[model samples]
Every structure is written in C-alpha cells, then in structure tokens.
Target: MISVVIPVHNEEKNIEPLFREIVAALEPLGEPFEVLFVNDGSTDGTAEVLRRLKERDSRVRVLTMDRNRGEAAALTAGFFHARGEIVASMDGDGQNDPAYLPEMIRRLREGGYAVVSGWRMKRKEPLLTRRLPSWIANRIIGLVTGLRVHDNGCSLKVYRAEVVKRVQIPHGFHRFIPAIFGVKNHEVAEVRILDRPRRFGRTHYGLKRTFEVLRELLTIRFVLGNRVFYEKALLAGGLISGLLAVISLLSSHRPFWAPGAFLGGSFLFFFVWHNLRRFNQAQKEGVFHVRELEI
Candidate 1:
C-alpha cells in the first residue's frame, strides 16, 4: 500500500480536480492506497470541500489544523499517520504532476533507494517569477550539496516510511531533505517530472520567502560540510597568541614586532587545533549532529 500525503492552504479551486486525478493516476499501480489531505487553516472553503470528499470516498482521510502551520509540520503529521510501506507527497497548488507517481514507485521498489525526488526538467509556469527562481535555486543547491538534483524546490517526492521517520526537518526546512538524507547515508535518486502552471490562486511564496529559502541553502551547506579539527585549533591559537602579545608589550619587549608575531603564530596554532578537534568528534559520533538530536 502507498500513502499519498498532500498539504493544502487556501487551495479550494484545485482540491477536487487534483483528488480525482491522483486517484486515476494511482489506480493503474494495482496496489491498495490511501490519500491523506492536510488542510493548513485554509479560509477559502477548502475545509468544506475536503469534508464532502472525505464523506464520499472511504479511502480518503482529512487532517485539518485550526491555525496555519508551515508545510514541514503538515508533512510530519502526515508521515506519522500514514499506513503504507511507501509514502508519497505532492504540492496542493496543482503544480506537481500526479502522472509521475507510478514511475517514482517503480524506482523505489526496483532500485532499492530510500527516497525518490522529482526533478522539474521542463516547467509549465510563467518564465519570470516561478520558473527562473526555481532554476537558480536548483542549480545553487546542486552545487552546494554535490547531489546534483535538478529541482530542490519541486514538491513531488517519495520516501520509505523508515526514511521519513529518520529525517529531521525543522519548519520551513523541507526543501533541504536531499542534503540531510544524503549525509546520513540514505540512498536518494531523482527523476524528471512534469510541472503544471497554477490554474487558481496566487503563489504562496514571495520575495521575502525567497530570501529566507536562500538563507536555508547556506544553513544546509554548513551542516553538510566536512568537519575538521583545524577550526577549533585556530581559535585556541588566536587566544594564546593574543595573550602572549599582550604580555610581551607589558614586559617592554619590541611592541610592534611582538604583536605581528603573535597574530601570525596564533592563526597557525588555531588552524591545527580545530582540525584535530573535528577529527576526534567525527570518531566519537558516527554522524555529525550540529545540535543534540534529542532536541
């Protein structure tokens, strides 16, 4: 069985049609499936529509929040509630194509990958706001993560139940799944999928959100980069050198020469100290955790 989890916010216009298309798209797989719709405080009669659809289809389930939470929370709730060997997720905005469901599952079952992400090879949205930003984001993410995924922001992806449970995503950090999963040695693959232009409401994202996403890109990079002890060493060396330099000046040693020597030597000492610290930490912990995982 496959569980499809979709997160929607103010998406009343496309909800019914998307539900129909998803049902038709999955029917060919010959596996029992369920669709879980997460309504993220939609004010546009979306909850009413979901309720009617839930009543009509026994295979459908609706999870509604009284207030709007971000997409990551909705996805986390869906993951915990899902009752399938594999879980699939797509956008509620109708931009993600349902047609790729079969192919994504096929790769997961046949190739034994923990996750399969959709790559928007050819987008159907407008050239400026939608397509261009997505293109630039994907390219920049590909370079930083070294995973070479074509679309980091595409909202179509499939994951094994275990993988979803293990991946820790903070709110607004869902787009960095590939980086997080890759660091943990989870097998991830990508395939080209179709993108559809919005037929209804305006895009939920804006310039502010785009900048926020860019900051997230940097966060992911720092999280995934190699941990070397040299960083800590450099810090220690700097402190020691500054102390020595001050002592030398107090003792009436050549002040100008002492400060320069202290600065150069401190930099070198700290570089080595930090690298050693990183090596030791890596040995102690199998994987890098920027913060305590329990939190």
Candidate 2:
C-alpha cells in the first residue's frame, strides 16, 4: 500500500482536478493506496472539496487543522496519520505532476534508497521571482548539508514510511527534508519530474520565503553539527573574547566598556548553547493540533 499525502491551503479550485490526476496516475500501479489531503486551515472551500472527494472515494482521507499551520506542520500531521509502508508527498497547487509518483516509488524500492526526491530541471515559474531564489536556495542547502540535492523545494518525493515517521518535522523545515534524512545517513535519490504551470490560485511563496530559508539554514547547520560543534564554537568565542579583554586591560587607554561588552557576548553565547542542549533533550509533543480527522 502507498500513502500519498498532500498539504493544501485555500486551493479549492485545484483540489478536484488534482485528485483526478492522482487517481489516473495511481490506478495503473494496481496497488492499494490512500490519498490524504491535509487542510491547513483553508479559508476557502478547499475543506468542502476534500470532504466531497472523501465521500466519493473510500480511499480518500481528510485531516483538518485547528488553524493555519505552515506546510511542514500539515505534512507532519499527514505523515502521522498515514498507514502505508511507502509514503509519498506532493504539493496541492497542481504544479507537481502526480504521474511521476510511480517512477519515484520504483526508484526508491529498486535502488534501496530511503528517499526519492523530485527534481524539476526546467521549471515553469518566472525567472526572478521563483527560479532565481530556488536556485540560490538549492545551492546553499547543498553546500551546507553536503547532499547536493538538485531541488530541495520540490514536494514530490517518496520515502520509506518507517524512516520518515521517525523524523520530527518542525515548522518551515519542510524544504530541508533531503538534508534531514541525509543527516541520519539515509540513502537519497532524485528523478527528473515535469513541472506544470499553476492553473488556479496565486503562489504562497515569494522572495520573502528566501530570507526565511536562509534563517532556517542556520538551524539546519546547527542540527547537522550536533552538541560537540556548538561547544567548540562557544569555546572559541570565549577564547577570542578573553584575549580581547586582556588586550584592553593592557592598553594605555583602556576602554573598559569594550571588555565588558566582549565578556557579555561570550556569556550570551554560552547561555544560548546551554539552552539549546536542553532543548534537544526535551520532548516536542503536540506541535500541530488537528481540528478534525476523517480517516
């Protein structure tokens, strides 16, 4: 069985059409599959469309959130609810072709890969607004994570259910799935997929998301480094600050405020490092609240 999870927000016009495409794409595989549409507090009739799809097909399931959580939270909720050995995720905007799912799943199984990500080599979006930022982001992500994934932003990916279920996905971290899986030494593969232009609704992403991606990259780097890296970083900072403090005291015109500020910065680094260690140990439960479940 395969579980295809889609996270949708205010995409009423595209829901039914995308469902039809999914059904057409998956029927040829001749395997039992379930489609899970996670409604991320959509203001439009997206929920109604999902409900209708569920009523028509027993394999359709709907998970409605209490409020508008981001894509990562919605995907997390769907992942938790999915019941299949093979789990797959794709965008709800109809830009991702469902036809490529079978090939991705095949690659995952045949290649013994834990994940098979989609790569839209020739995207259909605008150059400056969409492609440029995505290109920069992909390069930065590859450099930081060392995975060299061609398209980390593509949502069309297949994963082993057991592997993905073990991961704790935080908000705004959905784009780093390849890196997150790679950190655990999981084998990841990518396949070229067709990127269709959006037929309805505006894009949720923009240049602003690029900045958010940059900020989240720091968190990814931190996670990849673990506790030892942070400890070393703090030690280095403390050493630098201490040296500066000594130099200030030894100077003829001692700037007392400079040393105090340097010492304060060192202390601040240690404080954040300590809290981050504690945070890693703490349980992160209930990150997403579901308003309704129709499984």
For lDDT, the strongest prediction is 2
TM-score of the candidate numbered 1?
0.73
Model 2, span 139-170: residue lDDT tens: 98888888878899999999989877765566
Q: Write down the RMSD of all candidates, one decimal each.
A: 8.0, 4.0
Instruction: List lDDT for all candidates, in order.
Output: 0.73, 0.82
Q: C-alpha displacement of 228 in model 1, angstroms? A: 16
Model 2: lDDT equals: 0.82
Collision count for each candidate, in order: 13, 0
**Which residue ranges in model 1 land beyond 4 Å of their true spot?**
183-186, 222-295
lDDT of 1 at 130: 70
Candidate 2: segments with Cα more than 4 A from true spot: 183-186, 227-283
lDDT of 1: 0.73
